[model samples]
Target chain A: MTQLPVRTDRKLGLVIDLDTCVGCHACVISCKGWNTENYGAPLSDQDAYGADPSGTFLNRVHSFEIRPDEGAAQLVHFPKSCLHCEDAPCVTVCPTGASYKRREDGIVLVNEDHCIGCGLCAWACPYGARELDRAAGVMKKCTLCIDRIYNENLLEQDRVPACVRTCPAGARHFGDLGDPDSAVSQLVAERGGIDLMPEQGTRPVNKYLPPRPRDRIGADSPALTAVAETASGFLAWLDRTLDRLPGGGLARMDAPAKEENS
Target chain B: MNPAPSVIIFTTLSGAGFGLLVWLGLGLPGVTGLTAFGFFAIAYLLAVGGLLASTFHLGRPERAIRAFTQWRTSWLSREGWTSVIALILMAGYGAGLVFLGTRWTALGLAGAAMSVAVVFTTSMIYAQLRTVPRWNMALTPVMFLTLSLTGGALLAGQMAAAKALLLLSGIVQIAYWKLGDRALAGSGTTLATATGLGAPRAVRAFEPPHTGTNYLLEEFVHVVGRRHALKLRAIALTLAVVLPLVLLMLGAGHLVAALAALCHLAGVAVSRWLFFAQAEHVVGFYYGKR
Candidate 1:
């Protein structure tokens, strides 16, 4: 008779640091490269370098400029993918039981063979993590590099996911979230990490460290405020001189004026 | 939200089908000849046809038989089973009307109750989806029942006026219009509660994760303007409810009543389409699209 494995209270997940991330998009690319070659099917693109190109991607990075009223604009890059929630709504609403949570590690995954491509699970998900692969006739999502993470041949530290290992900024960390002593768990507890949409009540396991408080860039900065002011002042002076001259101020009509003379 | 053409046709067609059944059941005692039997057959055909059209919306149509198995957990399964029962009841009621005469009041009354139950069950299908805030309200069921009655009464009134049964049809049509208006306005808060993120605060989306549109955007992220929704609602109410009421009150005959029914159906189709199209799914919060 086959024996079942002993139950353990251990859940492995990711913790992302927003302050150190430079919006490099290396994680997104690495995830796609690994999953496309390793997973059930490659993320198919409708058009390559075409007007209406669309395809499925397991990860994406969003860039936003967060400007508080009192401080300078902070360019925040948010890397988004599946959070692998403890109370994942996507698994329960699935009528066919195709989408399920792994009892061993708390990783949520889809059994593509059982999925009918009905898209009901996608509708039930409040996080927008699931994507339907129209060409493959199934739903696709981030597996957190399941094939690479558990390979025994690799060294213990090298068993990290493609996204976490490839992150140049060291912003991504993966470990056992269930253990209070784990580095990721400690960072979350100390840094006051926040869920993206807590009101949705999905109870996502992944946590995001809040962006560091941005310092105000003085109006003296050469890139934006200083350059804009100088350019506008010069333009205004030229316009006033041009108005004083005969026939709209230019000696030659319809011919471009030299920058030095103007 | 994306309006799948199949769903639009299914709900609108089924509304008309069930609406026709409700009217026929109400008027069985008063009407006679080929007219009574004709109305009965038409209602049965529409009900079956609408049910069939709804099946096209399922991902696995071949496995549709499994839908009947989940009545304990799924309202969709309940609607399916109840509709079938209602059909059988209508068949028995139709046979009695043809053979046993109008004296079979008990059978007629039972058929009417079943028809009403079918409408109620169909509405509950949407009302039970807890994920969708707009569809989970009590008004959803009330709207379905009222709309069916309104549509059925209008059709009956037109048919009766054509056969010179004016007084009876007129009364039914007027009653349906009033009930429908109240139901439409009464359900506003339910929709607001579904989408409203209480107390206005600036929640800016800095970056979206993906460059391309995903399943969530394709299914639920509709960007219809506020002004457009208001204008469409006005058009729908006027064409569907107001015009029909005025025309019927003016003693319009069967042909006019038929024309009014068509206009009302078109208006109801737009209204129903907006009901699904405008519904905001809470999942958009993750993508930062809403």
Candidate 2:
């Protein structure tokens, strides 16, 4: 039996465009649908659609309204997931060798059969990409849809991952990052893509295009400030009136107060 | 870190077992040579037995042979190889002592060196894991080396009925313990640096991605209360280092000295547990849980 080499040079990865993302969360839902049906085990949800619906998900979008300075604001929706680094610490720390990086495609995969559910690989991951499947007693992560992408029957254009395929806003892209001529590479080059937490030295293959600047929302724009101030005043008045109401009004009262104070 | 019985037993039993061998090998020549030979033989078996007991902690024991493959980059592999070397050295040393008498001094010295190497390699296992801030310090190797020496010396003193040797070893042990404490304090400071945050900074969980507990929180972001940790450290230092040193200095009886060694062993075990529990991996920053 021939043993497979640990690393290959193909360098398969993802590139996300923050500029175009509307934070619709379609990628998140699609990822859950595909991984649950195809992966070793489905991501389980406890009390889902009930009081506290929660489950494992490979992709999640975080919406942050950044206030960089006075009168300057931006809503940046960051979709966080596995970066699949070149020097992946998660692979090195696994005592069982269950977590490994493929040299062929640069894909970091976990062999569920060999995993002991020790949770060591998850700890080693700086991005919090890997999650333990409690029911299976093994680790799981975004495979980048390895099973779907390589299927012989799929059309070339439709060969991308479920997240990329289902992304309604065209925020996600997948391709051979090692290929300098690839569309993803060209997009990254032209857009000046940045890696999150480059200080960690994980050498993440995933690149994020920074949020686009909105011309009308500039700090010096007097019209924008006037509109914001009016909106703030209306919200504050509504909040004060709501505070004087019954229990139903108490939850949202602080939101208007925070806006007025800011 | 959780006072997991398997790990505590592993560290304690292995430390005591190896420490006993070091003492027997070094002090046997000066004492009644025949009984010393018997002591060394018993010590070697106990050390091997302790190591064997540690294997039970592995989930896949059948695949343990594969552990040897990564010796190039793994301290764990080095430990395994060195442990085997130590066993072989001990066998040769025992043969020479039993059959060749005092002429085995050269081989015995080799065995002693091997014993020390085994302890050092074991120490490096914990020291090499950079993720655990508490264990990833120079003090780790120093602590293990000194603990072995202290345990071995005290054991030897009890066996040989040597009060002066016992007192000297006891003082050294206490000094090392203090140094270990200071090193741990410095490690804590370094941890603050690595985390890129100042001490006393209140970090609230702004927006955790998952509502359920994930592997990061379960494994790395362990939340042992600060008060409990401090109390444990104090008790461990007292019983494991201070009390033992004091008893030895006062020329305590052989039984009392032996008891002191056991107490210290328990204390060291507690300290090792806290070492893991209190360690905060930098990845906790992503979850905003640090």
Please report the candidate that would top lDDT against the real structure.
1
Supply candidate 1's per-residue lDDT for B136. Answer: 59
> Which candidate wins on DockQ?
2
lDDT at position A181, candidate 2: 96
DockQ of each: 0.13, 0.14
> Residue-wise lDDT of candidate 2 within B102-157, one digit each (tens)?
44566666777778888887787766654444556676777777666666665655
Model 2 global lDDT (CA atoms, 0 to 1): 0.66
lDDT against the true structure, each candidate: 0.67, 0.66
* Stretches > 4 Å off in candidate 1: A1-12, A37-42, A102-105, A113-116, A144-161, A175-181, A215-262, B22-37, B55-136, B155-203, B210-212, B224-227, B282-289
The residue-by-residue lDDT of candidate 2 on A76-127, one tens digit each, is 5667778888877677656556667887798888877776565556655666
- Per-residue error at A26 for model 2, in Å? 5.2
Candidate 1 local lDDT, B67-156, one digit each (tens) = 455455445556777788777877777766655565345666666777788889877766655455566566677777766766666666
Q: What does candidate 1's lDDT look like per residue over A76-119, in tens digits?
A: 67787788877676665454455677878877788776665657
